[model samples]
Target: NAGIAATMPALDYPLAHWQLTMAVNVTAPFLIAQHTLRAMRRKQWGRIVNVASISGVRAGTGRLGYGTSKAALIALTRQFAIEAAEWGVTVNAIAPGPVDTPLIRGMHGGSTAGTYASMLPMRRYGTTAEIAHAVSFLASEQAGYITGHSLAVDGGFLASGLLVRDLFEPAASAPS
Candidate 1:
């Protein structure tokens, strides 16, 4: 939760915050590794993929705490990856951008989400299936060589350097 803590201070207040974030984002993986390693040792292979966020990578506008926790989750994925390697287990992270999930669209709306798409080079928010594919790939046998890596399902949003601050500035001071 490095960078996110600064952005979403409110996230730190919820009674369920720690449990909510740590469950699937942290302890779930830890327990999975604890249980899966035995099978990995038996079969001599295993794959573990953590669903991270673009927020985990470049940081987001108001997602400070949420994003920071996600960033920590990414590091956790890597740490577990390194430790699990000797047991033939590979761990990876998938960083998704703004997806057309109810969580996002509900937070704003379809129109708002679409507006974000207009800002992105791809001109569309990603679908859940897109992120799922990356997870599936990482979980597949083909991803054996990959570990401690984060794949961006961002539709090029993470690549562009269009600072949002510029978009908010006056017309005369705009980047364009």
Candidate 2:
């Protein structure tokens, strides 16, 4: 699910925004999976790939509702995966980092790009195709053995903890 990112501090976040975010990001997927799982169970083969986000995996400012909802989505994926596994169905989630989508473009300011570049190991926003390829793989028969996994399509964002530029710079020569 490409859920809405209503950027705001938790204190300033409105109840309606929270409810709407949860409905679209969590509830909709739940209902869709619930409805389709039965038919897939009957068929004894199926693949369900839910679109989650890196925000779910990692906390970010101004993402209280969006992050929480995607986090729920990730959990839901696991729940469905465990039950569906026996029936030859695999349920998985793709947690993509900042992708260059219209939604993201709209949300990000001019400076946001530079900030993201500094933070992300790849030093650039991910492409929609990159995210799609990951999803495609998970849905393919090749990924039959994989289930209940939230594969992060981020370009080392999750792995690059404590990314300080100063740390990477050369140390000054010791005084004689």
Q: Lowest lDDT 10-mer window, candidate 1?
A: 1-10
Candidate 1 segments exceeding 4 Å error: 1-20, 162-176
lDDT of 2 by residue, 1-176 (tens): 64677877789999998999999999999999999999999999999999998888988767799989999999999999999999999999999887897877876668766776677889898999999899999999999999999999988988885222333355679999
| Candidate 1 positional error at 93, Å | 1.0
**Residue 35, model 2, lDDT:** 95
Compared with the true structure, model 2 gives a TM-score of 0.89
Candidate 2 Cα lDDT to native: 0.87
Please list all clashing residue pairs in model 2, or write none if there are none: 1-51
Model 1, TM vs. native: 0.79
lDDT of 1 by residue, 1-176 (tens): 11122333454556466556656566666676678778887887888777777877885555655666788778988898888888788989888887887666676564556556788889888888888888899999899899999998888978984343433444576576
Candidate 1, residue 140: the lDDT equals: 94
Structural similarity to truth (TM-score) of each candidate: 0.79, 0.89
